[model samples]
Target: MHTTYLRDLYHLHWPKVILVMLLLSVTVQEAVSQGQGYRRKHLEFYDDKPIHYGILFAMPFTRYAIKHNEQFMTGDTAYSIKSPTKAAFRMGFTVNAFLNERFDLRTTPSVSLYEREVRYSYPSSPEKIDKRESTWIEVPLLVKYKSQRRVNNRMYMIAGITMAIETNVRRGRGGGVGTLDTKSTDFTLDYGVGFEQFFEFFKFAPELRFSHGLGNVFQPSQNSLGKGIGRLSTHTVTLYLNFE
Candidate 1:
């Protein structure tokens, strides 16, 4: 009975899963090939030697949904975002060193900027809204693995640890009256997998990466509204541009 139920669920969700896998495979193959090609050609131009510097520009491709998943602590007193679902954009840069054709070490330092808005509506009163714009600078040291160099690009995978500096986090109301500034910093674990395609002058790779924060970014125990909402970590996805 359990096996039958598992098979039924798989049949229902298999289409989406297969599509995602296909897309991931194609893109990663293209990216790895491109990265390999660029390294070879650039090295030939500079005294038949290898170039260690690889530069990539990345941005998140996914949409931001609602923070509907609640973290309830002590009944209705816990804090949460009261707004509907929304989307956000994040971008950053990375520079990597080639240890070999299939293995490399990369230092990815990025800046992400986004805004969060929380609102509450009362039965017979006006809605209360709170807004915050935050930016973070993160550095990740990654070890990358790729398929053998070939004319057709191979897929690549990266695993790394990221140390993030929460450069600036500030909040202000719609009228810009209630404003609070928080300069914060923290650490995190970063992991991602993607593929690259090699063009004549540039390499393009769309990567899906996730970073989980290790520490709280907020200070003290009180919030802007005197309600205690602990610090929240940032999460992102990035598309990378590689230049040799």
Candidate 2:
């Protein structure tokens, strides 16, 4: 019975015992007598230099799903019934800092351009509608985790929230004919994963990453203008050259 209990205890508690031993070994070291006094050290502690501040440029590969299409500024009624294939483009710049080798923080301000086209057929008139486009400027704050840190490189993942202000919007031709405005503000959540390779000269890092927008990019409408019109989120993929 005692032998069976010992075996069962080993099965249940061996992993925890090993982990505790490993952690203690990493964080504590025996004191050594050096001439006059004894000094203790932590074996797994290493401090890297600070990341002063830097710039990041990004590009996003993006696509969209037009929900509640009938309520949008589309010229074609048929487009409200069907979805189309198109990719949007975005560019961004950020100021970032590394709290340590394994953690970082960044605030990025970006501009994005989007275009969607659909053919609309009028019931009474035999005519088809042409083109439409939208653009916005957004800013995001992100916190990142570097999975592993080497001499000059690290692989990381980032997640954060953003506040975006919109400007210079053009929706279809004759979209802003009279008393209609197409500008708005949006708050969104962003998430992504990427790799960063840093070089010694000027602290430049070449990185590849993706950013996804989680909220609609349009303002709430009071009438038929934006009723039932779902928010169109955006995405971005880019390579960055950083300096700190």
Candidate 3:
């Protein structure tokens, strides 16, 4: 079991994390070399503007943090439950308002498609899967703190809140039984850090962000499948590439 866990940890579950770390390493090394050079800064006055616009591209790894209800302990059908991380893509536009030399307020509005799942293991039967597919329209209001630029690279940290509304949700039944359902709305606290690399035409930043849902998303169950679940909250880790 331990070996299997290790295999999944590196090979199945954390590919995005590995990719992000590798990219961050390469980008940081490149930034160090560029900063050491006495080259002219490309967008020397880009920050002088009060407002700016950009596009966002990201890969989000999401999962549900589950808590068991009384039924889970009293029942005999399902012996265990597990939730795994699933990867999804997002595309959005960034609208940024400059507040000072060190701070900027930004909003990124995007539509995301998600496939999140929960697993149930039976005493003597095959493992069952409950999958939820949904589309969300999200707007994140964030405040960014920027470090002074060196040559063309800068570091920034962002923290804020995100409001998400569910749309086009397709809920499916597990084993012809009751289905799992969630609320139509979600609120999360978001925080992250990034490195900025300035170019001749645009500024690029690679950011890693974390989001934790503030409210329970679980809906009351009509059958035993969902009755054993007490709370369900969203957790997402995302790697974003921003271009301005």
Candidate 4:
């Protein structure tokens, strides 16, 4: 009787254990097959083309690097000089020529509209602010170095030079004081990093760039504000979005 009871127990549980083992094996095999079939590559042929064209829009914050003259230290009444950064807009078209797999030469021509302010504080009176506005036609020539594309994204660094011609300059007058006078042309050194994303239709890149003027933009005149300032150079930070 004991032997018969043990035989019946073994027969009842053996099929359930086999069924669980088979289901687990099937699930693992399906997962392995799906993993082997998945592909990570997107826009696999994007870099094969030699040249490309694109449009870019940029937002820039610009300021002046002010150098104070001897008057700032000697004069008792004029205590401090400060220039604050201001935001601007830029829109342009891009022309890219590929030199090789890792390098490209680029030129972008754009129009920028910006405003800057210079503030002066005195010991006896309230602070005075000088506002200046400019509309500039800018051209930049850059060399870009890119890393190997990984999946759908890549990283790049760019360095270049830019020439900016100010087409219009506007100023305001207050308290019988005149606005700042600046040169119409400026040359800047540009350096930046960008991240590129490739999709089926196009490539998109967003960049952050810094520009430092190599030339002194200050135009000195007999005016009190101009005479007190020794040197003024342009400094700008720009964020660019490009579609190619």
lDDT, candidate 3, residue 52? 93
Q: What order do candidates take by lDDT, descending? A: 3, 4, 1, 2
Better of 2 and 3 by lDDT: 3
Q: Please say which candidate is ahead in TM-score: 3 or 4.
A: 3
lDDT of 3 by residue, 1-244 (tens): 1113553365344646655684677577666776676777899999989999999998888889888888887863687776778888899999999999999999999988888888887768988888888889999999999988877778889999999998875554332464677787999999998888889999998888889999999877565678778989999888889999
Give the clashing pairs for model 2: 59-237, 59-238, 60-236, 60-237, 61-237, 76-120
lDDT of each: 0.52, 0.50, 0.83, 0.79
Give candidate 2's whole-model lDDT.
0.50
All candidates' TM-scores? 0.62, 0.55, 0.88, 0.80
Candidate with top TM-score is 3
Over 4 Å off in model 3, which ranges?
1-4, 11-36, 170-178
Residue-level lDDT tens digits of model 2 in 42-146: 222332544445555543443433356544445323323222334456666666676876777877677777554433333465434234466777777889887
What's the true lDDT of residue 25 in model 4?
49
> Mind sharing the TM-score for model 1?
0.62
Model 1 lDDT at residue 199: 58
Question: Candidate 1, which segments miss by more than 4 Å at Cα?
Answer: 1-51, 61-92, 118-127, 168-183, 224-231
Model 4, stretches more than 4 Å misplaced? 1-40, 170-177
